[model samples]
Target chain A: MPTPTSSEASGPLAVETVGLTRAYDTLIAVADVNISIPKGSVFGLLGPNGAGKTTTIKMLTTLLHPSQGQARVAGFDVVRQAAQVRQYIGYVPQMLSADADLSGYENLLIFSKLYRIPAGERQQRIEETLSFMGLSEVARTLVRHYSGGMIRRLEIAQSLLHHPQVLFLDEPPWVLTRRLAMPSRNTCGPCGSAGGLRSFSPPITWRRPRSCVRLWLSCIKAGW
Target chain B: MGQTLAVAEAEVRKLRHDPVELLTRAIQPTLWLLVFGQVMSQLRGISSDGVSYRDFLAPGILAQSVMFIAIFYGISVIWERDSGVLYKYMVSPAPRWALVVGKALGSEVRSLTQASVIWILSALIGVHLRLELGAILGMLVLALLGSAIFVTLSLIIACLVKTRERFMGIGQLLTMPLFFASNAIYPISLMPAWLRVVAHINPLTYLVDGLRTLMLTGGSSAFGLGLDFAVLGLSTLLLVVIAARLYPTILT
Candidate 1:
């Protein structure tokens, strides 16, 4: 793991983990992991199939509580200030998180409301997000009828509807086409080479897309 | 309140894609009212004075139908968990109880379709319902309140059981006991000694009590309307809290 020196990436930390660990009853899925992602930096956690990438994201996103150690996102403790963390971070899970029963626009609108975007700005924000993700044409289509890639884009649109400070993606471009992955740049590309919105992408070896940016790779081995 | 309404708005929007579900839900209530009520109303000792068995059973079937609609709300929660829609909600700024109640409120709106179906059917069959605007409005409150309790209870079950298969089995396990043990089918007076105790403690009893008083002209609450509302209202609040706490367990 390449833990950057202070001079390498200097800014308020978008994400920081220290001795982070998660354990099932008898097995530790993620053990004593530590990484500090400075705001405006794009990074990925590379690992194998059973390498605990999903569990780590789940903990950082406040979806699951870590068994040991502590981590924070957007300057808030993932556990103690989880609500605040949620306020500042946008997360798109690997699974099909978009509601199949709803149209793409409705999904984004619901998320916009949940994020408490002002009512006046919601329509334009959702429209802009749909267009930004290349989903404007099919905005009225039910997610149930969408192709895998379209569904993935809608999910991405839902997360970015809030303009969060940091975006945490479960496994972007995992099983997705090339064009499907770049919008994260629009949302995450706040910083040029030095800094911007921080994104945590842990691409599994089998599913990593060819176009993945290789700015920095912190590889976690199996059972990590 | 804004966040809670938003979560509910999302869930409610799904019904637009499948409005037929509301019509289908009305089927069971139809059977209970037309078939079961007709047969049971003939029995000598079932209904109290001045109330025919059909009129007596109208509100009960309405309560039962709404209960049936909401009691399995856990299944959808399990689906949300699997599809990762739940993860989005979980990680949102919305409060957990708000999520639970918002979801309950959404499904409760769908249950009203069944409630209205039963109401229309009750009027058609000449059950002599209290059709005044106020009574019907009051029924709306009771129906939503009744279904909200079941929805929150279902969410609690979803949080505990987690998986779809187990949730289905437990959902089935709960609906019958919750239905039969409550005053939805028969009055508390007709229940045996042990079940009478269960009926008193059952939140559905209060719902039925309130629904019965409001739905029928001559009907009155076995337990006063105040007690009925107090019990169901408090129970919904309690279940919301419990479901919210157990909600994170779904991720495991």
Candidate 2:
């Protein structure tokens, strides 16, 4: 594995991309993008559909390799040190990620092991996550039986199990609305929603972490 | 290592939630033993190496059952992709190889279930089986290796096709040829010269040959038992690496 760059050790940015680009044949999905997301602050990439919002997220999350240029997440280069980048971040994609055949508890337990969470903390954390996500009532129930809202909450709970430092949400406003509607007691706060990209939705200011939120509402709504 | 087992444990856990799926899957093999094996045994022209044709067919059916279960595993990967489980797994810290191994291990569990069902049915139908500790262990090892190979092959195909429809089409096309090309239903000696050569190279041949030798009371295989293990072991190692290499392409 390659060592981290010198600036990465003391860098102020949690995520940084310089001249990052991705292309398919002649279509440039993401092009020459340069942005810096500071640590501990909420940052949102606002653009219309196909404005490369999801593509940007994919590159940053190490799910899609950049066709050209560089990106670093948590001081590790996305292309060179994808495994290291994976260790520091949690991603909730546009789609639901849990296995419907398994129960809510089983989904979280599997992720706990995948993330190599210590065996001692696994059960405790799973229980806590279930309660936090409001999934405790249906913990043992198959995820296939879970309503759409419950499935999203379970996904959020699974992502947060390892306590990642930087969390990425692709098109989360719909879920965010539901999440915003969640009782304040169990919701992960706005500040924890770092490195997010909101596209084409009405921008609403959050009362909590008011200074931390950055909204991008730049264009007329386009198809995603 | 822990991650690999975790991946496998997830699959096994799914089985626990729907045990009926296992029982349902056994119906095909059970019918084969109760109907086809008995009907085929009446043909005296096909030599059975001194054991009853039912006994000869038992191990062949076992290999075929395992192959069918494993070859369709790629379809699950396609489902996982659509449902978001594959994406979740991709971003994890676990090595890609662990994910592949875990899926294969899970398939092994399913294969073993099918094997047990076949074994019990064979005993009930009066097929002469050894039932010794060594024979049972040998059958188990062959089951695991056979399942691992087919499961890895399924993953490779999933990576190449990237869609449920395409994967299913390819899976259906491949399973029949792979089954018939090998000695799963009959001995290679009965095959034409051209297919006999293909059977020599087919991995399934080794599995059936090994199972028939260990499973039957007085069975002898043209290929030795050690060669079966060697071929299956080598093929499994190579397929695992290939599957791991192809895993990342699944998202693209």
Candidate 3:
């Protein structure tokens, strides 16, 4: 119930971490670290496997509390103001996040409901998101039948449905740029300009022939 | 409550796309009625108090089947974790309690479907049932409550174990004791002193007692309707709360 105090309500940073740390028993999974990402820009956390990139994203998204240190997402404290943080962030983890059992539209609908999208706007938002992700064609197709890249797009669409301020994809494929380029249409471009989203994911870049938002890249190695 | 229902609705929708799964799951309960019920009915020593043994065992089998479905539900939770679906839910704005309750509510839908099948099978097998509106409604409530309790318990197990092997082992260990200790198959009078104590504490006992009373014409509850509901309801609420608290730990 703690509301984000001070600049958190309307800060320039989409994400910031100071001495952020997460440690397991006798092993530090994510050590003391600091990071800052400004609004309206993309920041990618780049590292090899076990570099704690997913763990860091998890902590910032309020899915995993930090073992020690301070972290904030979209101006809200990840731990003390996690509910507020969740409202402002969309997260796609490293693994396949889409529910394969349901159709693509059904998966988005469920996310829409979970995100508490306004009932009146839910349909419109879903359509826009599906189109944005180029999933409109297979909207009714079972997700299980979709290819891995299609599933990833649907998962991205799910995160974007809420129009989160900070969109985090833990480990999107490097070819995501090509995937997002399928449509010459401006998809994430509008959100970037509207102050609705900041992309955060290493190995993920969205490039359309017409427009692109540049990214700042960071790294964590061996739990550092 | 809306978020809770949304979580539950997602589950129901998944099954809705494949209704055959529900019917397929009913096969076990059908076997229980057609095979075990008939085979056990002829026993002379088991006291049924006048209502036929098949009729007595029908509710027990239904409750057992519900337990069987719910107790191993942790495996799915683990699967969701492995598949990364749990991450989507964990990071959602919905509270942990709502997510747990929502999953439990979905299990109720599954349990009720099986209950309907058991009702039809019981009738065909010549078990005289109450079939009255009030009784049917009561049975529905009992099944839902029972399913919620068991599924929530399953969720807690999922949180603690967080692995399929451990969860399956624990689930298998639980179902047998939960079944034998309950007054599902026989009167509580038949249990040993210690097991009678365990039966008194088992939520499954209350479910079977309520189901037996509501499903059959001559069926009666040893603990009375009020007590049966109170036990199941309170236990369910408690388990749901516990499971919700534990839900986040699975991620850790």
Best by DockQ: 2
lDDT, candidate 3, B23-139, per-residue tens: 889998899889878888888789985688988898898888888888877788899998989989989999999999889877778888888888888888899889789999999
Candidate 2 residue pairs in clash (backbone atoms < 3 Å): none
- RMSD to true structure for each model, in Å: 6.3, 4.5, 5.0
| CA lDDT, every model vs. true structure | 0.79, 0.83, 0.81
Collision pairs in model 1: A40-A196, A190-A196, A191-A195, A191-A196
Tens-place lDDT digits, model 1, residues B43-106: 8877553688888888888998888889998789889989999999999999998888889889
Determine which window of 10 residues in candidate 1 chain A has minimal summed lDDT: A204-213
Error (Å) of candidate 2 at residue A87 is 0.8
Q: How close is candidate 1 to the true structure, as a TM-score?
A: 0.89
CA lDDT of B183 in candidate 1?
A: 76
lDDT of 2 by residue, A1-224 (tens): 12233354446677889999999889999999998877655566756677898888888889899999999877779999999889767788778888999999999999999998889989998998888677899999999999887888888788777776567776664644545444443233343232343232323222233222222212222333
Stretches of candidate 2 off by over 4 Å are A1-10, A181-224
Residue A84's lDDT within candidate 1 is 81
